[model samples]
Target: MRNIFIFIIFISMLFVSLSACQKEDEKLKGLVIESSSVEFGSLQNPEDRELHFRVQINDYGMESEQEYKVRFIIQDAHISDLIATEKIEVPETYKTQLLRNDEARTIVTGGSKEIKKDFTIDEIRKIIEKDEAVIIELYDKNRTIDREVVTTFAENIKPLVKVNPNAKLEHIKLKETNEIDIFSRAISDSNKEQGISYIAYPEYTFSLAEESYFLWVTENNGRIMNTKDTYTIYSLSDSSLKEVKEVIDKK
Candidate 1:
């Protein structure tokens, strides 16, 4: 009788251990890193720049009853100095809510939920610009971790500048004129084909400030199209185009 009781107790303990392992395995069943790489275009200043990313975790075993936290670490000394050291957390309620949403369904395929957050890319650029090495580590709530490395190169670091083509046309006026000429050129070599080559000459009211008008010319088939360049000239003084204080064309 004593031997049988001892044997039963040992079996019970073994079963419990196996069950615990199974539960943990289930928690991480569909957990995966969707966009591990965080890209920050170019950092001209030391001000902090952040890049957002998503971590996809699938709960195949059971509904998420607890929230999960994620932490970030920069192992390299040079890289660490340039970036802010911080860890981000995702609440359980937030995860649960997303899991129940339709959009979350798209991120969590085969029974999973995706949690997205942003990280500092500016910090990484600062370190790299100085010819330093960067190591990025992402830690999950369950202690699972992932990392990536970025090396400093001449091609990888630069300044961020964009040409806003949607800028408003200044000094517009309506006049009866034939054959209005619109001049446009490609800013980049690759954009030579994709660049705007068409102009639109409206017969109605047609007058705009020289600064307000942006000539976007494009070539179609074998002929040049000018109608594409003609658009309702927006006012630079308006709130929509006010943020666009200026438009700079490379060519």
Candidate 2:
């Protein structure tokens, strides 16, 4: 009789342990992300820009509500922008853990996620282009257990233009002689069939001596239309081409 009682007690304990283990296993089941992309327009200057994203864990079974921490990381230096780090909580009901005696205490399984952002053409023209890596992370409360995620964003590689060695032209036309048009497409190629190709306009005021004009033109885009050092002089008194040498001589 004593032996039988001991055997019965052991069987009951085993059943209880197995039940607890099953409950905990059930809590680690589901995962989700609320939103994948967040946009940051025109950060700092017109050049700096960024994007944000979030990942959420969900549908975990729990006796009471609990919370989990989340984080972000940038893995590839060339692809992503590391703007800032963020943390969020996952509710207990959305997370699960097994009983003390259960072999499966907590089970969380998911794949790496991704988020992306890009620069506009105008923004690319204003800044130097380079590749960068971005990463995101999701962490537990103590920050001990963290899941790192990574993705890449391509940098803009368009050419830009700036004015250098400013020269004064006499009687410039506001409509036809606009500096914006002149500098922007100053490095464009003139083709009879296509007219002009891959030309970008400048975006600054023409100044004297101290100011330098700079422009970016690439063969891939097109060739510069005009290579003359002097400006065309247009006047009602004499509508003729005068060498810039003549103007500089007068100065």
Candidate 3:
């Protein structure tokens, strides 16, 4: 009789442990961030940041009654230490099953309700060290992982020349030196018909040292915003110009 009682007690504890784990399995499976096309080559301010990016999370284990938050983290990839944490409150609507192309999916994908909470260049630079990591995840008070994804953002920011659509040409500046070598593309006869001559700055008034070729652009040439460019820039270091970056006005 005594042995039977002990066996039953052990069996009861095992059942409770298994039940706890099964309940824990009710959380999401994984999270992913939509890719950003933010090319801040010479990005100057946080105002130019891509503030409204989306994050997709698996809702397989969301709690219907409780609220959750997505946390953006930047850390050292190798050291695995937190450098910064930015949290965005998840909407109450996402606390349920995710639906998709006429079928039930398990993902909660959307943007932040508060635009200011979006990550920006200032926040990204905090973790710009070599081999750093950026992580985004969802978590309720008691729920955790599959809730998260680890990744990084843009790096290697360099100064590049730009040609505006309205025929305004601008030079990207280095922290120390504003001078760069400029080269002109051979304008074919076909392109000349489009009034491909470089136009002066329409808004700002500035003095040019002389006929600076690298600083000119074919105004109103229908150039792609980010894919087409008219100048090859070279760094003006120590009285000599060395080709550094080829600037493109990509669409």
lDDT of each: 0.33, 0.33, 0.36
Write candidate 1's Cα lDDT for 6-121 as tens digits.
99999999999999998887554434233233343224422223332234433332244433343334355543343333332333332333344422322221111111232233
Error of 3 at 199 (Å): 13
Worst 10 residues of 2 by lDDT: 231-240
User: Candidates sorted by lDDT, descending order?
Assistant: 3, 1, 2
What TM-score, over all chains together, does every model reach? 0.28, 0.30, 0.33
Model 2 lDDT per residue over 156-225, tens place = 2222232243643232222333343433333222322222213444322222223233222232232221
The candidate maximizing TM-score is: 3
- Models, CA RMSD each: 15.7, 14.8, 13.4
> Candidate 1: RMSD over Cα atoms?
15.7
Candidate 3 regions with alpha-carbon error over 4 angstroms: 1-48, 51-53, 61-67, 76-93, 98-132, 142-145, 152-214, 217-251
